[model samples]
Target: MKKILFLFVLGVFFFVPSLSVQAAEEFLYICGPCSRNFVPIAEDVIQELALEDNVHIKLVSCLGACTASPVVEFKGEIYGHMTKEKLFALLRSYFTL
Candidate 1:
């Protein structure tokens, strides 16, 4: 029993670090009054951003910044009142070469 317990603890010690090492990338959270309002444009942004590996872009509903529809938050930077043109351009500048 003691040997089993010791091995279990050792196994956990070896495993925990790898879990934290999983890479999480920054994304632009585009929040509109409805997901439909911006998802098509958002899909374009995602496709554009996806060209660069490890960048994740997703569209969400009501990020509580809806007073400014089409809000883009990247790495905690909040941009308000986004248009598809501005958003597509801004993301390219930020996420691409």
Candidate 2:
């Protein structure tokens, strides 16, 4: 019984790291107001890049970029004044299929 439990723990330790990498691939966030104004653009860019699965899109309440109401957070960087073209260009690095 003890040996079985030890093997389970060891197996999980080896398997968890790969999951983290998949979790790390996520890369899109739109603030509350941004969502209403920019979701379509965001969706189009995702479809254009075929990143429906490769990247994650999150709708947040506020990213502290209200000065630039339509704000987007991507890969840990905050970008305001978001436009479809700019978003498309920014996402090229991550989704190049």
Q: TM-score for every candidate vs. truth?
A: 0.53, 0.68
Per-residue CA lDDT of model 1 for 18-76, tens digit only, reads 88854446666766454346667766766766643445567766676657766777777
**Predicted model with the maximum TM-score:** 2
lDDT score, candidate 2: 0.81
**What's the distance in Å from true for residue 87, model 1?**
1.2
Question: TM-score of predicted model 1?
Answer: 0.53
* lDDT leader: 2
Q: Candidate 2 on 36-78: residue-level lDDT in tens?
A: 5798889898888878876677888889888886799998899
TM-score of 2: 0.68
- Candidate 1's displacement at residue 70, Å, is 1.3
lDDT of 1 at 14: 100
The residue ranges of model 2 lying beyond 4 angstroms of the native Cα positions read 1-24
